[model samples]
Target chain A: MLGVTLSRWTMSYFAAALAALLAGEVLMTAGYGFPSAPLRAPETLVVVHVVAIGWLSLLMCGALFQFVPVLIARPLHSNTLPLPALVLLLAGLGALLAGFLQLAGTLDPAPPLLPVAAMLLAGGFALALYDLARTLWPAQPLPLPARFVAVALFFLATTVTLGMLFSFALTTGLGSRPLLAVAGAGLPLHVVAGLGGWLTLAAIGVSYRLLAMFMLAPELEGTRSRAVFWTGTAGLALTVLGGVAALSLDAALAPALIGGSVLGVVALVLYGADIVHLYRARKRRIIELNSQMAVFAFAALAAAAALAVTLIVLGRLSEQVGALVFLIAFGWLTGLGLAKLYKIVAFLTWLECYGPALGRVATPRVQDLVVEARARTWFLLYYLAVASATVALLMAHVLAFRLAAGAMTLATLAIAAELIRARRLVDVSAEIRLPAGAQRPHLLMSVPHPSP
Target chain B: MTQDYLDLDVRPILRDGGEPFEKIMEAVAALAPDQGLRLYATFKPIPLFQVLGRQGFGYAAREIGGGDWEVLFSRADIPAETAPAATPASATPSAAGASDWPAPVQEMDNRELEPPEPMVRILAAIEEMRPGEVLSALLCREPMFLLPELEKRGHAWRGGFEPDGETYKITVRVGETGDKA
Candidate 1:
């Protein structure tokens, strides 16, 4: 298999998706769609969906497509799905953004376009889920991490279905007054399903494998890891379903929400402990910048939970809702993604370039592909900006928020530069002179680096 | 199958001069049409297995002791696709396949080992393998990373999950093409 590895296409799509995320952030920083903008405003919705669906989802999907093959030790059921999925997702995303723009009263040419957008987006998710399930179908007793992914996909389907129904309500001015009222009340459920059930659950599953692999620790197959899995699954299920009952049926499911949130927190706390333990038991004593910085992502998750729980306990849900979302998205999920991205890109690039001649030729280690100290500074600045932004949003300080956004934009640009360099194998192959008449195509074109 | 084959031990050359690929290849070029070769090594000879197999030879290995293995090689006058029971599993590793592969000169359970450890250990073991040795290893997953290394070094290998599906067992034979499927 000449330079063929799982999810190469998916990773390429991830690169493109990251660009879209950065663009959305830039637009938000420029005050195009932001905190000061009307709540649920179309432009703001555009930015949010772009980051949520376009960037983060694509990144996660690409990572999964690659890692699953490694986990199962077989090729994916179909390697060609990612390219088509990417196309569908982007097309759907563009349509959804246009629909949002139309809702903002900017483009009202079509009578009801949001439903079509929703259908396209649903189509994309359906394809991704089908491909993912098929890839995992043959495993007799699926691994813990794979099981988590499977459950998360179920939540994603539920979330998308509700989202599509809500889009129809918003666009077509649907029939029943009671249905509209329930849909309006149920909007937050969609948010929870997407962020909590889909994104957070999927991340936990992948992290279990990645942390153990990268840290050189024994696989955490103990009772505690199982605890994290069950608690998380049960918690997300109750929270979403309970929230639905309260919204649609106007029933008193407060206990369910409270109980579910508590379970969710328990899951996170256990997961955090597992992470720390894994780090302690690691055979590789020297930790790299990416894994080291990943600590902050974990901390941010705990902090976000604390704040959310406090808000719920105090009945101050409306006070700083926007800020809480910001911290989770930027400080936790995006932060973790960025940290992992640099490492993954370097690993894949190394495989692509140096893999063929690995035994025959002297090869550079994966760490040699990029300058860590250079990336370290950017990571620091990025986290600082996130922290500052988090504080400002918490305090309702407008000027501070804008300043932090500017800093984040700068830090993001720096990191993007480094990421691109890693992808291109910047300093790896340019200086190496191939022997005359050597026909080794990939190695000569440039190559992979080394790591665990 | 020949009852008696020429015995050639290259462990001494490997320990002294590193890889004895050229010396072994020279001996292969001198073999008769119906002749078979028995080689001894410190560890499974991974690279040599594929190298010799490419020349139309079937091989099996059996481990005699730690850091010691004996592999039997026979020319395939009929272009046999499958490797015959190499030495009748001098000692089989406890697994489902119930294969009669050569006894592993070195046995490693890499289930607890992480990525790159499995790769590194396998590479290091094979480097010390004399002609006709075999190495067996169990891992958490297939060492996809090691496959390219095996190809680069001219080795033959086969691996699959244990009946439990959690444990992946692999075998490497030097100077003989091992089973691919």
Candidate 2:
């Protein structure tokens, strides 16, 4: 079997991630974040962290738990550790949100909890990183996808470390100049490391493998893929360096940032081209719903990159940065995450339920587990709502943005419902009886069985 | 568990540009359940290994002098009372041992098929195979998703990319009680 075991807690992580996503979306819909509150407001920070750490980080971690083994062609080091890691992360996120509320004076009677949140989050991330690293350690000279994940893990550590420092600074009253500098100037660095390095780079790497596998296209293992990795890594490094330099009040920050942005754009462009090539060369002429919806996410990524660059060039980035971040977070990263989850959930459920029965009795194909016709509308609604929200943000139309956010929340809820249905085997035909000894899996929890 | 051997040589047929497959199958059909076959050919017959393997014949092949090949096809269900004196000079032994597996009963070329379809076809095909029967398939990519499922269903499989470095070939042995052989 080549030792590839299914990750038991991946569904649990996904459930938590989706809940966080819905929470973030609902918060925005209720006018908690910008365009309602100032971008720097603690209320906005609460929403941002809810989405970034709660939704995206959990989603990525869950996926990697399942896929890193596939990428390395090895079994996970430990399956028991993920549930505890998830528990720590959720608790940390809860504390972090509460701390933000305290900072906003909404919970003035509460003690300072940012440091506690930081410690918990750091511990959780550490455990995850250790488990993944142990799995990857033996498989030296990793494949391209695995390399991306390895690099992203480094950035994740850096992001968490920076966040911890910020939390401490804020809690300690930021009296020292260095602490003040880290608290004030390091926010952008944290964002770049977390969103760009940890999240986007990892997403790009994973997508390269997955898209090719699903499409049955030739994997991009040649010079182009190498170019993407090198450029993307170098760009993120330079940008992060610039942010560090800014904290130290260095004169080299501007040039470093500019150079980094240019390289990042080049990497993204190459990646976009590679995706197009995959679609063009795909053997499956009929594109599946997940792959089709991922196109909008890719477009959003390109648009966000272009818009950010244009704003930077015009020296108007600060003024419109809120809208740009909204596009990147909701339209690009979250969009891609949601789109892929639709297929991944179905695929995993099929493996769980039908795998044992395979070749022993009649079984439904993985495609049979998902009704694309029902999901297609929700996906369309999601992208449309995100677009309208982005437009409203650009126009500084607060009420319009809120309405769009409400629509986005609705679409996300509908998609989540579909994912749940897939997990429950609700979409599978009743006529195809499950083979003897093959039982339906739980929706959120994995039932223990003898190891294969 | 000793059985009488029926000797067949296809080298002369190949020298005259005649197809030997039909003659080979005819010999296979004529053999008693307790009998085995000794085959000689001008070159190593890789495809025939699977062809006969499906019929519950374990094989051991060795290269003879002057580019000729000698192969022994034995019934796998029978206990090996004695090891053949000639070591398997050229036969590639799979996980279950080369001489312990029968040829694939069902063969599929799933190169152009998409995800799940290839898996679906393979699983469905194996369900119809008799216990101890083997199936062979060719796929465009390594059947990553299919491998675990095969394990879960208690089937044994060996696969690798062909010499072309693109096409993947897999041989699966149906397990007793739908368990791994």
Candidate 3:
């Protein structure tokens, strides 16, 4: 194989993340904690962290490690960082899961591993951040996407710090005042920082570039992109500041929180409009399946936003925040991840196997690497299951959530299988081949052929 | 410029500054294998040099009068010192002559585009290119995916990041390596 410029461990990140996603989805389907699982219940915490840290964060980190250099036009400062980080993360996740199970009384003598796990996870993230930050440093007047990612990294560092602090207080029994401070002021602020500032903001930044480029439309470098960036930043800033004030001074910053939430919504609207414009402006007349399905992910985000606003307006915000989060995580964030992954796998596979064969003889295009006709149906099924599961979880119907999760788990596994097939160059199973003197290149059974 | 060859004066048709690119191309294609093409333009036409050169054509140019450049593109096979242009400027009622200029290679930028889109666009453009044309793309990173595809199709390519490390440029010539590779 020709030497590839991408990070050596990049695919390992994807493989690890996908494995975690499958485990997390299966956990949800198992319904071990059931109706008794409150938002803060140890079992619930296990599931949340499994999805957030183990799956989504890992996926994002892998992608960023690969794309950050590409985005900033710099070679990675350190290629070795991912291996240690991956090891630390997976190890920390195991410890954290055990600690949570102990808290839930499912594991006797689980040994207070939260603080230890927290430190390991923090170490892993810190190392990852160092590599990304170094790459970003040389690209001054950073592109809009890089700008967003920079802020998201800062938020991620903060999120991990706070989480470690929480674990430290619980395990070591020190800093009682600070521990009480955070617990009293509420931990929703922490959740918001991770989900809103770290995850969503970064996703928005990445998609801004990806969507426009993929659609063959002009980048949203105008007012709309700026609007999303600034407003989203301001909203997150307000929330973080308010959380600090509440924790330290015991002040209730309700009005500031509301103001922040409204600003966040405004940012979302601008971003949504920008995306719609991109779709309309696309020169590629036909939309591919991955992009077509990503529309639903965006719609899911919009729906979640609308629900949050309605709950806030009706004075039932506290009661419904959980449901809104569910929608955002499973419906919006995971949906986008799945949709994008479907295409990304095929692309990476093509690069691995057949990239240099272009314009030479007959070679399969990237689209041909994907069995989209089969995978496309899975996308629909996954989204449908997500919607049903979201509604059931919101309605607090345990049985319904379980049923929907089962369907989702199955759909996810089916799609994942296709990804594996593509990665291994098993598309040869389709028995398609391109003959000599072909005027146009298209998909066929992708057997790896050495470039002439 | 010295009138080494005034067999075809395209100056009248170029008054609108290469008004019809198609017409310019048609005048080019009309040149017989033994003949050459003379074009009058206001500027250097530097990009066209590369475009036509890839098709086994070479040119010598000199200023005619008042900023007009008279460029004579001829088959490189012709002994350059004596071969001269012969087509009349008003070779009129011209149907769009097949483009004699090596097909213009399309250039695209796919920096920061999601994976596969860049690959998709490049492949699509390559499929549509006529023989001898090239396509150059500016990318955010080295297109690791494109190299193999190019090799398998027998098209040759070379790329490297620009001096500004962020901009990567790759050039692919369709059907053959031509001279650029």
Candidate 4:
């Protein structure tokens, strides 16, 4: 087995992503966004961008930098490119947030930051997409996981391009009629492409491989996995088509959206079935805590889909859109991200600190790095708070939602602390750390020294 | 033409993490001139082929279910036609062109194992091997995650799915710098 080399900038990306997540959660708890402000208000846009680009996008990119190699059994196109991409993304996000503040009149006479942010973000995403594409190109007949990532990258390009168009239209004030129409009606399309296609699809793909590897289950490259990919792709395509139609004020948008939603639901059902199969067929009798906790995230996905369908059937979807998005963003995506990070942080730490010494020394198992008992409480609390928040949003209970958000922030902080402990080798036995060859890795960055 | 044989089962010793090399050697020394040795172990005793090959033995190996392998080592000087019962078509050393790549120093049945474990075992085994030594492994799937790591560590490998199209067989040659750890 070839070893998975440490992606030098992955931790930094994770660090920035976590900070963004905390910022979003804190903002919500403080009543800065959404229900307190109108959905399309500048304040709401700031919170949305902070979470969408700053947190989820960064997390996905970071994971891809490390796992894409494992997926295709190839190294990244350039190890040196990731740091610059991160910097560009962060800078772009900062400018975008400030630009939103300027639009809200919170900042006086700020430079027209929208177009500048747009260029920076486009450049950043371009570098990332190019690096990933080149790495994926030579691996012909890619495995199922790599194929998912490839499609996801395509959507990411769509997402970034659409975003840039919106930014330019907002800043330049010389947009074409169609372009202005897109900016007016394309927000849903942007969210669908970014959240559903780029982020969720990539998460599904990576999770398939990671769960199988962690659970000792057989890889799911069968008909079910193929169905998941095709259906998911087709669903996204139809949704994007609907988005385009909406931009043109065409009557076909409604049917296309409905059809796409149905297909997307079908894909989710198949994916859920595949996950059950994986868990049932796993060879490891006693599964780890991370895998166990991920069930909550899966359940959230199912619940969110079910809620959306019910809302549509009851003709209340427009009113409850906020609740649905909240469930999807926090309950599904963020929940899964947090659960996986619990394991990935420890796994990468072990690889960085002990991978070279593997087979030569008595290094600790990956499970030995974290106190799951302590983290378990935090994970449970986090999910409960998300659930509460979703219900409160549906009931339009602003205070209740804020309270739930505060609990979520606290839970996230506790889980993050546990991750930091794992990184610092706090839970690893003293004997394992005190050995002659054991080196305590730097907290947030990998040292460039060659393997001992 | 039928030779007497000595039987040895080192599965328990291997399972207990004990080295069975000295015991295997003692059995070899005690073998009668007209006798061969029949070895039964949990995995194919690949390194032992060269060890016994040096002592003038040509071996025939066959999987005997449940990850166990039976290898019969007979004197190579005996003509193949005369030792039909013991010399199967897969007999090592007697097969032309196959002898260039030395018998693997370590053989692993990673077919039942999961990901990372197979990678872990193979990497650990290679780390213990001397430079230029070869190790063989049978896996349930293509060793995708392990191959790049091998290349990273300067080891060389060749692999393909077996006739069954399910089992993947790989042979890795440890590089000069592979054993640096």
Task: Please tell me the interface RMSD, in Å, for model 1.
Answer: 7.1
Candidate 1 wrongly placed segments (more than 4 Å)? A1-4, A109-111, A175-181, A429-452, B1-99, B104-114, B120-133, B138-169, B174-181
Misplaced by over 4 Å in model 4 are A1-4, A249-252, A447-449, B1-99, B141-154, B163-166, B176-178
- Candidate closest to the true structure, highest lDDT: 2
- Where does candidate 2 stray beyond 4 Å? A173-180, A249-252, A433-435, A448-452, B1-102, B130-132, B152-154, B176-181
Q: Write the per-residue lDDT of candidate 2 for residues A1-452, one digit (tens) a residue.
A: 37465688999999999999999999999999677999989999999999999999999999999899888778889888888899999999998988988888898735799989998999999999999999999999999999999999999998998898888887856666755776677777788899999999899989988898788888888899899999999999988866676666734456767888899999999998999999999877788999999999999999999998999989998889888999999989999999999999998888778666665566777888889999999999999999999999988999999999999999999999999989888888788735554578789966434233
Q: TM-scores of all models?
A: 0.78, 0.83, 0.74, 0.84
Per-prediction fnat values? Answer: 0.22, 0.52, 0.17, 0.57
- Clash-forming residue pairs, model 2: B53-B102, B53-B103, B54-B102, B54-B103, B54-B104, B154-B179, B154-B180
Per-residue C-alpha lDDT of model 4 across residues A1-452, encoded as one tens digit per residue? 34346788888889999999999999999999797888889999998999999999999999899889888877778777988999999999999998998899998635789889998998899999999999899987999989999999999999998898888777787447766787777887888899899989999999998898788788889998999999999999889866776667734457767888999999999999999999999877777888989999999999999998999999999888989988989988999999999999998887677766666677787788999999999999999999999999999999999999999999999998998999999998898873545567878776433356
lDDT of 2 by residue, B36-145 (tens): 89999987775566556667787878899899999888884543323231234115443333346775545666787777678877886776666787777778877776
In candidate 4, how many clashes are counted?
A: 5
Q: What is the lDDT of residue A26 in candidate 1?
A: 82
Task: Write the residue-wise lDDT of candidate 1 on A296-357 in tens digits.
Answer: 88888988999898888888867778888888988889888888887877776665555543
Q: In candidate 1, how many Å is residue A37 off?
A: 1.0
Q: After superposition, how far is residue A60 of candidate 1 from its true place, in Å?
A: 1.0
C-alpha lDDT (0 to 100) for residue A238 of candidate 2: 89
Judge candidate 4 at residue A246 and give its lDDT. Answer: 66
Q: DockQ for each candidate? A: 0.14, 0.28, 0.13, 0.32
Q: How close is candidate 4 to the true structure, as a TM-score?
A: 0.84
lDDT at position B85, candidate 3: 17
Off by over 4 Å in 3: A1-4, A34-36, A428-452, B1-181
